[model samples]
Target: MLRAIVKQGLRASSRLAVNRNPDTSSYVQQLEAEWETAKPFSELPGPTRWQIFRGFQKGGQYHQLGMDEVMRLYRKQFGDICLIPGLFGMPSTIFTFNEATFQRIYRTEGQWPVREGAEPVLHYRKNRKDEFFKDCVGLFSNGPQWGKLRSAVNPVLMQHRNVAIYLKPMQRVNRQFINRIRELRDKDSAEVPADFLSTVNHLTFESVATVALDEELGLLREVNQPPGARKLFKNIEVFMDSFFILGMKPSIYKYFPTPTYKRFSQASDEIFDTCSMYVNKAIERIERKTAQGSTKDEKSVLEQLLQIDRKFAIVLAMDMLMGGVDTTSTAIVGLLLSLAKNPEKQQILRKEILGKLPSTDRDFSLEDMKSLPYLRAFIKESMRVYPVIIGNVRSAGTDVVLYGYRVPKGTHLLMVNSFLLKDEHLFPRAEEFLPERWLRQKDGNEDSANVLINNSLNPFVYLPFGFGPRMCVGKRIVDLELELTVANLVRNFHIEYDYPTETTFKTTFLYKPNFPLKFKFTDVKY
Candidate 1:
């Protein structure tokens, strides 16, 4: 089909050239020469179709391998550019590890960029019997529909002022999270449970809910917890687990509802219903507050979004709850592990934190957050070393050339950025946990301790939140939550992980922790 399109395009171009002026004809001839010289898409290096199919089977080479490891293997076998044949209703994907290719792809992605992953969620939303999401498909959607929603919510979510409104509320939640960590640790060991990721999940959920639902869920507190909060948290876990299975692996869930799809559908329904209930309650509260003229100085994220449209607000809230929890939790865990492993780095971060606040009891103001360059750099370095997502995936908005190959429009391009983020060429001493690498040099001079990353790093290679218009919508919220949590954590305790650091994360839709997180937290004296 693609070859037919190429041939048809060439014939049309040839016909138009006969009626063109000399300059136009020369330009057309030059374009044709470039196209003819470029290698065909089929000649791109990768596994054969049969190999890809068999490797994904029960006992094949790619079986049971995390997506991160598989991407690494592909790079090792096929070098920078590789073609992954389409299998089991999935589209053919092109994986590129070259930094220039990454830049070219983003440059051409134009307005209304099409990101083609999230098929399972898209299918569920489109085929719902109730048609609940017929109008607003939220962030996972593409083209005009995604653009509309993104534009509507940008004022409430994307702006620094709007996102800063949640700082105080989120700080309260962070305080509770710090206290919960103290309570959860063993008295003798001063270490949290092996399943410490669950605790971090609660913190992320509570933080997101504080902004999204305009109320505290009390998830991190020991007593007086909301009854539905636990159930909502569990349902989100099930939703993420099922999404990983359906999204990453090959299956016939779209034709006939598989067990995983069934679980996914049920979890989706429950999550939507619960979020709807909370949002509706928030609507009523806002209405009453408006009626009595008793609103606060700052509005919650939900309230600001509701002014746009109710249904849009509900869908956006649900998307936030679903997308925010697992990704942020994984990131928090990764950052904590990075700090725990490098005790010297952790101490440096603590000194930075203490110089600003002097006490854990004080809340983090916006000004204080801006001043902590090391804390910000530490987060960036941690994510560089341990990115939560494998890479960014996008479909070609139009026909384009990539790495001397003619890639047709609609081909799914997976920018395998994980390899580039840690590559020695892109980052100096990439393997080491050095926060100073991201810190900007002062007095127009470079020091041995600090690596000037701006001169060496490609802007496109280190995309933790992604790039351009289709980037993560909740990036601001996630950044604030992470910064607040890490600051309060370093100021309050000495984080330590007394174990060998080997194989820490596995890619399950998102890169999640593979092993137990038993981090020891000794109280720090100010």
Candidate 2:
């Protein structure tokens, strides 16, 4: 049925193309002809609304395979593009794996791109009695509202110089994390427990808090942690879990407060209150410093953001804490696993680190980070192989053509490019862990010859951090965090995973490892 529909569309397009007029410019006429012949949105191929509803029901294909696998199955059946009829009050979505379509959609996304996924959070913020979010709906918001928040925070978070200020503080947090790992590992086996991901979460929270709140939460400490830190951590966890259900899956969270929605709301409230308290403390501290006439050259991310607007600072801090912790921790775990499974690649990365630092005690400077190409390449490769999110989503900001179909404005577009990361045609030997593939020949390194030289590689196919104006604001910070953590770990430990099977990941709110993280960390002797 899908093949027949596609053929009919192609035939129609061909017939329309032959009717071009000679009076108008060829370019204008061609575009008009293409637009007129494009397939109707209804004729785009995928399972029907009833089929989607039944498929998600008990013991159905969607239920058995899960959304990630179901997407792959659809790709196989319907080719590169499929229109998913929304179920249970959700908007209809178009899923495309075509690189050209991805590029076209992103390039045309106007001044303010609309990323439509966090409906539950938006609904919660809008309906709050206090109207705390009336002025700013935060990073999850759309159009001019989101644009305002993003514009205010971009200079503070996106600049390299601004982000570099957090390196020393985050390094302190990484040291504690390394120490905590040593304490948690078994004496005989040298392996951390199956629940080591929790520890990683703590490490990430501590690191983010250093930048977001300008205070050491000491979450990785064995003895004393700051008050409300652990609660904030737990709440963020619940928020992530519930966000997947209420925001991603079908639910009537807006009309009626379901059990999942209630839990999500509660978690969100705690997260806001705790972050607000810390932000207030930060504000008082800043005021006190100012009163005393203190001139500190290096200010925290929060301090810089607070200079703009107090409320914006608080909202941005909360969003960073909620978004940064789980996502970064998950990415860190994935990178560590990649290093563990491929010992040679780990050693190569370690050699690069040691060549620059010479000793484990040496502190990471911004200069040191700039010189380490292999370290950066390793990170890029890891993300390519194990992307945290399945792909990016953007609501069509304007009428656009996608794979010969006219997508109307406000239609949800799911760009499923994760599969493209592993396509052999795009990246030669896509299964192997080769960091050298990311190294450019312009760097004039010995590994330049080994760099996978594919001229046809589309940049749009490999967007781990997304694209356009809505690209991740914390990208600079997250990059530094991953670099610091991995550098410290590799400098001190010979990481290994002794388990027979490989670590696998599942897609929830993000792509997280589904298996136990029982990694063995042996000390590296100089």
Candidate 3:
């Protein structure tokens, strides 16, 4: 049937072209036939054909698309799951605006796995050289290895009771970030040290450095980045680019030697070489903890992990650093951009903060962060709009039927989050930045107040931090940081938009506010 269509396209092309060279005409004939065949796929309403096809295209797409742009493309091309093209390879079916589809994937990661082909492994190994990353983290392992590390690591995050232990270090780090912003504001220039990516890159790495290792990188305070700090982040950026962006379709290199393949190998080395330093440092810290008889009350992340097994804990500690940096930094950048675009919302959040704390007084306390309702809502809303991971990718391991589409074993499957976050079925005026959307409840499970698109509040749609057992283990830390940071800044300073209403947003990994916005640190008017 496919051959017949191709032959028919050849006949059609022969009639259309004035001078037909066989190679030229044959390629056109092939592409035209593919388009014609793929056109029917858009008509299939289920996720089967549409979701898979869009997965491939999205796999191929590497733009710095903000959440809005990504959703717009997904909707415009809804439910086209096959990879064959139309209008020069662009799909017409936007992804189904299905938040339940989002729910299905988020709630079901055991059903879907992150195991990419060996080509992607090269990239992962390059950026994460730690033995535990190579062997332990759920990101790398599948069954027992994933279960073991996940079991050990997740408890650390789940027990928010323990976060109180982290409070003192986090206060020092958050102050560094706010002070860095203040220093930039004082700078007398237009560009005035923009690039929120670079800013967040420093903060998160420093957080993990202190929280995990009890070391101060001082990235926020340093006039220049500390040794290995800048390089490690650059390697992270490269690894992300090589994996998500220009690095798709790497299977071709599995069979042949090519320039692109060579570059991938080189990048893999640079990423690994840079990451090794951190891992080695982690090992040293774990040993030091053992020598010093560190207890839970006195332990850093490395110290606690060392209780498990020294080497294992060291690698796992490094794993925490690698995993923690990109996700939270991406999120903070997203929150800042959303705040910039929604000045009214930012002011509302600030009020929630100021209402709680009469003044900065001395500095932020963890207890002060909890009561800021709108502040939390503002961060939740931003995460909804410009999520970092966008959602997990899974492999079916065996043949399965999803919504009646035949999904064979070994096919890469995507479950999209950006599509659902803006699904009109889930929220009103889906694309607008309305933090208030998170504040209401439906049939009255008032505890769902913190839930995004709370069905009790709006249809159960929130996966920026992911859902269920495999959901992000670092969520509590991120939440604590966000609520604390925003509350402290707003309590002490008047942070307002300095950039024009237009083009306040930029994307690279996630949305970001143009800096030089000068979150002016004024003494609170008591």
Candidate 4:
């Protein structure tokens, strides 16, 4: 199909050229055909299609080979690029540790970078085509339709100015969350509950909801928390938890009513319905305001989206909610855990936070976030060590040479950034948590540390939010929430961990800490 498109395009171009030599035209056609059929997948070193089950250690399932282990083995066995035969129903996946190759693939990607669409999401939307998600298309979709949807929504969702609008509301949510944390912990005991992740999830949901729906859902409130909000949160967990089984593997669920599939379906339904309900209410609110002769240009993301396409707006809202709940909350957990384990770093961060903003009671404003550089550095360091998304997958948009091997067009390339970011060759004392590594000197000088980073380190290897045009859209929003939450916590109390934290990560869907994160928080003198 790609070949046909290229050939057709070449023929059309040839026709437009006047007085073209026949021989030159023939040569161009041959080159065009070659480019079209240039996929040389066999040249790449990768596991066979049937080796999915046996690729890893004995008794280890295909997807169960933790990303860390997978990267280590791949680097040891395969030099740069290695192919893993298509697992489940998906195509062969290419894992690369080569920074140059990663950059080449990203640079070659066209407007809509080819990638494997989320099979389970595609199936769900198709199944519910005539329902609430009839016009819903989001990040899960691929090709021209996905491109159109992304282009329409990116302006509204990806803008820094737009994302800044939610800061005050998010800070309000953070304050309520801090109060909730106070309720959950004791002054003497100072131990946070095991369900702290859930609390963070609520805070994230409330923040994203207020911005996305333009209505305060009051999810952080202890009493009278909306049932729909709880359902949405629970279902987001269900969807993410079930995604590994339903998303990575083939459609066994399509034939058999597996437990995972059922949960995925239920979660998808609840998410769509709940998001739709809020979207409709928001629309009604906008309508009421417009009816009262209000002429306001200020528009929430949802309102901006609705103006372009209503179904698209709802779908975007649903994606934002699910993404905010797990992905952002998981990072917050990792950041807090890291800070807890390193009291020295925590103290440094606290000093910066309190020194910049004396009052810890009020929420941080946009300007306040700018004043604390160490807080930003801390978050970056945490993400580098423990990224929420293990790898960013992109399909090769065109055939390219990777280490003298022919990488075919539309080939799935998994940039194993999580493992690469931790390579000792790239970062000195890679295992240690050093936010100062991200800090720069006040006077312009090529310090030893900065020199090493600039000369030796391939900056592309540390892509926590991905790269190029396809970068994560809500990155600014996540940064805002994380910085604010951490600033507030550090300002108010000192954080410490009770037990040694040996960071063991697992992947149910996304990479998250396998063990319970227990932190002891104590009030500090301000």
Count clashing pairs, candidate 2: 0
Candidate with more favorable, higher TM-score: 1 or 3: 1
lDDT (Cα, tens digit) per residue for candidate 4, span 212-301: 777778777879988888787788888877876676654467667688988998899888888889999988888999999784677777
Q: After superposition, how far is residue 226 of candidate 4 from its true place, in Å?
A: 1.2
lDDT value, candidate 2, whole model: 0.82
> How large is the C-alpha RMSD of every model relative to the true structure?
7.2, 8.8, 14.3, 6.4
lDDT of 3 by residue, 1-526 (tens): 3233334534443343323223355644653454443434224443344443455464534244554465456546645342222222222222333444344332223422444322354444545535434543333555445445555665555577768767778878888877776666544432224454577677787776666555676678757667676665565555555544333321344445355555555665565565456656766766686688873445566556545554455545445665677777767766666765676776777777767666655555667666666777778877877767544545544443333244444445555555566766566566788776667555765323344343543233566765444566677877877776666666655554455546545543334454444333343456
TM-score, structure 4 vs. true: 0.87
- Clash totals in order: 0, 0, 19, 1
- Any residue pairs clashing in model 2, and if so which? none
**Cα lDDT of model 1 by residue, 317-344, tens digit:** 7788889999998899899998899999
Error of 3 at 372 (Å): 2.3
| Higher-lDDT candidate of 1 and 2 | 1
Off by over 4 Å in 4: 1-40, 54-65, 129-136, 254-257, 293-297, 443-454
Which window of 10 residues has the lowest lDDT sum in candidate 1? 1-10
Name the lDDT of candidate 1.
Answer: 0.83
Q: Pick the candidate with the highest lDDT.
A: 1
Judged by whole-model lDDT over C-alpha atoms, candidate 3 comes out at 0.55
